[model samples]
Target: MNNPIPPRAKKIPHTLEIHNHVRIDDYFWLNDRENPEVIDYLNQENAYYKAMTAHTESFQKDLFAEMKSRIKEDDSSVPYFYNGYYYITRFEAGKDYPIYARKKGSLEAAEELLFDCNEMAKGHSYFQMSGLSVSEDNQWISFGIDTVSRRQYVIQIKNLVTGEILPYKIENTTAGGTWSADGMYLFYCRKDDKTLRADTIYRHEIGTDPSQDVKVYYEKDDTFDVSVYKSKSKKYIMITSESTLTSEYQYVLASEPTAPFTVFQKRTRELEYSVSHYGNHFYIVTNKDGATNFKLMKTEEGKTEKEYWVDVLPHREEVLLEGIDIFKDFLVVSERSEGLNKIRIMRWDGSVDYYLPFTSETYMAYTTTNLDFDTTILRYAYQSLTTPASVIDFDMITQERIVLKEQEVLGGKFDKNNYIEERIWATARDGVQVPISLVYHKNCKKDGTNPLLQYAYGSYGVNIEPYFSTTRLSLLDRGFIYAIAHIRGGEDLGRKWYEDGKMLKKMNTFTDFIDCSRFLIEEKYTSPVHLYAEGGSAGGLLMGAVINMNPELYYGVIAQVPFVDVVTTMLDDTIPLTTGEYDEWGNPNEKEYYDYMLAYSPYDNVKAQNYPNLYISTGLHDSQVQYWEPAKWLAKLRDLKTDTNFLFLDTNMDAGHGGASGRFEALKEVAKEFAFLFDLEKIKS
Candidate 1:
């Protein structure tokens, strides 16, 4: 077969000037989604990708099947008791969607179907149903559906007892609503049509037209987004407006749906906090008074002002207070210390305090599903690099645990003992130690001849836990070593770790990843000729920046829905996440941030140099990162790069940020990615 020629995007130079800096973008014309020429160009690139990899079609199919075979076709999640019923989400054999059901009082009771997503998704190419909220009486349920993949859901209600759907519908919502204590009204957040930001909170009375719903509150700050939810105590409905560095909350009595909401605290610059209700006080986790790692405080129900707050747990510099779960007798706290997750169990009366024991240093553990506040049973989940995920229920009094369910890896070929999982630290250019979690087959060697794939997402304080994956088994069995680099941009080590990697210090994220790659090569775990790197979204930005800095360090790279056109995207506030992310990427309206971002913006930094093999993907309907960012970046690379190495752009026409709404359908995307790596390595089954 002959190699296919890559698509050449027509150049129409468009000049943009901001902060006294000028840039000439030749492919700026591709940003218009409504233009037929833009669609034609995307289709041409799609065809080029198909033609270039046509020989790997069979291998890709087999790879997809191999990965899919490891999954249990008929599986149900562990049912949890909530509001007099046990709710379950189960998948049927050979189906694309899950079936949501419930049983009254006990698991042995007759099941009542809530939503058969397979049936609901029969006619749509893309489908998603989320934010399922059940009324207090259990006679009604509310859900949001999005068929276009843009995440703009339409909310609807259904009568669980009569099996009749409500006539009213709410559009352009954040997909879920909070039901009032009397179940008479629903409170939901509304999104702006253009930017897709949730900026308003509204209340909808049951059996009334949504157009007549009352606007309860509006968030005037463009940098902050709003959301509505019921307190865990079920006594108050909360409206929270939050930015990256600040937050403010309001609340109203759940029993009085028409009552006005009272402000718990006014928004102060750089003051970040969250509220939870228990008995007669509201518990807060906050970063007040320079508590960079956050601290727990409590205030009486009527005295929610900051002046009335008293310390429950004072600030600790080494530990990050992630969150808390409230109960009548006990308090569960989720914390992170020394790049590891810890779950602490403490009684309200201050008689007992302990932490759930975890054996692996590189594992992830967190509390889950303790909705009933009166119970002594505490449910949590645990997973490691080699171990499958397991859900365990613990009795707070007896210190006993029951394993409710463990993820079943089918095909009879999986054994935890066959793999080695460990954590290793690498010194960065600045002498800071970065953690890397690695897993490989026991038979693999550290001879530098082995192929290794390193991945990281160093942004938004998001920590990518070292968890098990059934899909990753294919790589391990194929003699591939997989690694997760716990770099500085994430909150892996604590709040300071994230703060040191953002704003003017953003370059640390890129350099830390490069240092980790070099460390792997220096340790003989993998050579530069066999090293592969992967990251998506902000992590994709890391991929772009590192390759620009040191392209020869990686043999191949996969960037999924990359946010490469940073400066341009940040300057335009009309984009979905631009305005709200000013603190994240920095406000480019300032000359200092503009110069710093342009210095590292991947698309702006493309130049004449030898490049590695690249596989880039995006969705046409992506609301978070526009598809044009990747399209334009690829065009620039094709025009400038001097190498003959392959560069492919794949555009998913039917999906959004998250590709393919189905469970099995999403696997095909992974298969394509794996095939790209295998083909480059000349590995064929």
Candidate 2:
């Protein structure tokens, strides 16, 4: 952790390949182990806030409290029965605890549920895998819990009428389960991951035989993706995943768990599917023409009933649709326009359209909907630069909107009101347009000299949109500009966009990010020397690419639990997330594939160059990406790089890819990141 980063003019050394067993004892993994002087410096920072001056935890508590009040009086909602209560972990006394709140009829009784995570974990430790559902008649309640390993689970069905609980313990991975229409069939998908390659879908006749002796017709295979959807008494299972891209379809009839599954018929390589059933028909949306726009097709008895189009915009990139929400005859469709970055809702017959304005001012959004026959409640929550996120609830029928919550900053200290969301397009060396979303305080002198932190993740068909964040408010409020570089390897532009950024075209994602950084400098948003970049996991690759390609252009780099040794990880089958990702990253076993991967693989491409301030982090218990990749790479950088901005290794001993065990812990990590950036850049004020 003491080695200084090497300058771009110095020669870079090749990383040594070693059979290092990655586990808990690595030196980089530790908590609260900062330099004594640094600890003293941090304690002095407590004059403002205790947890850390980098994060305003006090402000956050006040914000959540205010948000709770806002959730009240926001009456617009969807018709279907939904559990209005959600439980979250709270830190009280000396232990982590669980709290819940229930939304009673027309009144949200937001009271803390008297439950503790420690107590819950004592009996049912796998609360993360727990499931909750109340029967349609509100007479029966069913819930399931998992035991860490052994793929074991216990399903408990309680009779509210008699207050009797019948629990069954089974050892198998339950992909999903639902109650049948007549409440007779308890349909669930169970797979023996220890012995079998593919999981089978099953129908258990509750109160009859245990889960082992269940019925599975035409047993589902492992090659395709299968998902079970539940809506009241309706039970529908969709199985896709046959082709490289799986499109979902509705399952009408039950299949035998003992037999093999039938091959899907109407599947095309160019198309993907998602299904929903209502009114004796299954609504199907297909992207056969392109990954952007979709054609809506409704089918009956596994046959097409009528085919039509929704959100029919110009190209695939312009029109992005979710599904056909059917309510009696009227249908609701949601559309996401890529170019404009706005969400719009329309009817099944393509009539009565309304746009749910996209909040371009935030970092990202987590959207959810609660609906029924007549009413629909849409909830969108996000975070931005100046403004901490506040949820907004929209009533579809009356079109009435309510601000569910806003962070009530203590003493009115933080306000992002003057923040602006500017969409700037940067052209890659190849002339491809890479969009960068920026959120920064308005009155912050535009001398193009402020510190700019550009973050990006260009892999795994994931999309990073603009959403609100209260924790990040600490940074933006501190005279920093927050931005997200929407490059490649994300669904922001659909499947083709992802396809172009992965495998052989992997370099495109890196170049696109580089272009974004360069464009920011050209636009006078910030000076090239003050520019900072970051990426994690897939995005971590982006960080490495930018740092190595033009280290001098950036002031610092934060690569968290990165996959730098791509060629090695892709070849080793023992690592998780590799075999399945072969489609995304080429096979290193093949000579051609190995050569292609090595071209951009950080380790292989390392050479003498001026580098930026680098901070590398990893977790020991990462089940997805191996921690060894970064551990070994950092060791090489120590022996190779030839300059002076500290090269730190902050590896977590007991964490995973998420980097923390609790919610606040994650915020602590964010604080450390901000501290590192602020320290390296020597930011004023």
Candidate 3:
């Protein structure tokens, strides 16, 4: 058998390779609990992971440290950690930069201090403390800090109007900011340590004492989080639970926080309303009628439980309804028909609202907000063949649109006109139609010689749409097409698309993605020899399985932060994301589930086979997908395979899933992925 791995990585995404890295070893966790190697690896990293958790326990010390550094008096260059106008100043060597807040008014250049990456990295796994999420109003900033143990950190806040730095108040070790309608009540839920699993929701007065004026919601025995939202009249408060895939929600009196009552409720299911809001009345769409279909309904009497469901948009056998929002009297939703997503707007009165004619073949909203009762501002990104990623603002009432601050908040020399986007359809093995979004240079010839790259994550009912990226432009300029395989494992074509690509139907996702690559070849969109595939986490599993099953189809493959060890990990409930994944990937404890998962568990099925130019990157700090899985799989490959496929590991000792702490750091990580792809150069046919 003459199997060989090609030089795809070096030629495509443009990154130099580190070769012949290690002498193969026996599987690291093969000995299970008695493994000495496991102890060595654990002792080394566990010490670091525990640092953040331990420091958080002593709350005062960590808070005191940040207060001293960023919250000190006379530090005007830092952001004013205020409620509305909150932003931070980064005084760099050659430039003075400002990190924008969600709203404007809270802090000034002097009042807020910038977070020190090095200082904050202490006591955390790189994977754990890697994200920063600001509240909708932009009054408070919440970030994950210290990974030794996972605890969401409460950063400083500034009064939007005054430059006064509010006293640092602890929300919860695990609880996050659940800002109120007025932004005064920052509610959060804490897992009662005694129970360890179940948590209790608590409302914090933000700037007040940690003890007084605290309101507690349901004290359940399951792990949970709170999502706070206000109705159009500001009379209702919606609090959704943080649970596994199917979490139930409870609505309470917003003005009467202490009121012991739930207004209306809907438990999360395959097709039920995951979330809802008010226009003049309650509007919701759920897969409740059937997993493959959605029944849209409106409500006026919320407290009364009634089956007053209306069918605004019936189930399209192919179109997937991604999400919906109530701006004013209108309801806006983004739908994925075939594989292209377009934003559609409708009215509560059952009349056609102004529909923003599907302009960008690839359109979707990231998040939305209401400016007033009649007008709303939708913040999202829009792109097509002629567009790069730019944040846009749409007036829901006036139907006016504006481009917000363009990206490159960090500054870069990016050419916008070099690349364009397009939609293409691929036929699946089961005669299903799949759509892929492609981005390449306008001047590039379609002679099957251009390097082509494809990315897909068909899991967890998420819809992968198009967005702008400068890191990817390097490949387009070099005659490469960047694509997103809108395959199964997502609601790309509605519930049926997801149902067909999940659990026992998971192989459909892999084959659909493969079929997409084949369609590209059949249509001469690109050459198979130049084709490359990549994905992280669940998508990484898809990439791993396809390459192993059909190595000849691809020239190169990159699986970063991959979840390839399916059977072993999913069955062990201890892994961070496993239990919640059972709804998506069937629980392997039962014989049926065990067989289904074993059917696709890539790590366990590694035979003496040739692989695509392979690059697997894992982070020791990855609390989600443990580093040991990929490390062990590569070891098996080293021992079993005689092919020239390359393996590379750049474990971030500090990052969580996404890797990197700041925006610049995050870009660097993304740049690394692009570098690997650029070097591989999807060899044109």
> What would the per-residue lDDT of candidate 2 be over residues 510-554, giving only the tens digit for each residue?
888888888888877887767888888878877877777777788
All candidates in order of TM-score, best leading: 1, 2, 3
- The runs of at least 3 residues in candidate 3 whose Cα sits more than 4 Å from the true structure, single-residue gaps closed, are 1-175, 179-185, 191-200, 205-233, 242-247, 261-263, 266-271, 275-280, 301-319, 347-352, 360-367, 376-380, 395-398, 406-417, 677-685
Please state the error at residue 251 of candidate 3 in Å.
1.6
Model 3, global lDDT: 0.60
Among these predicted structures, which one has the highest lDDT? 1
User: Taking the tens digit of each residue's C-alpha lDDT, what string does model 1 give over 382-481?
Assistant: 9999999999999999999999999999999999999999999999999999999999999998999888999999998999899999999999999899
Candidate that would win on TM-score? 1
Per-model lDDT: 0.94, 0.58, 0.60
TM-scores for every candidate against the unseen true structure = 0.99, 0.76, 0.76
lDDT of 1 at 371: 96
- Poorest stretch of ten by lDDT in candidate 3: 7-16
Error of 3 at 24 (Å): 18
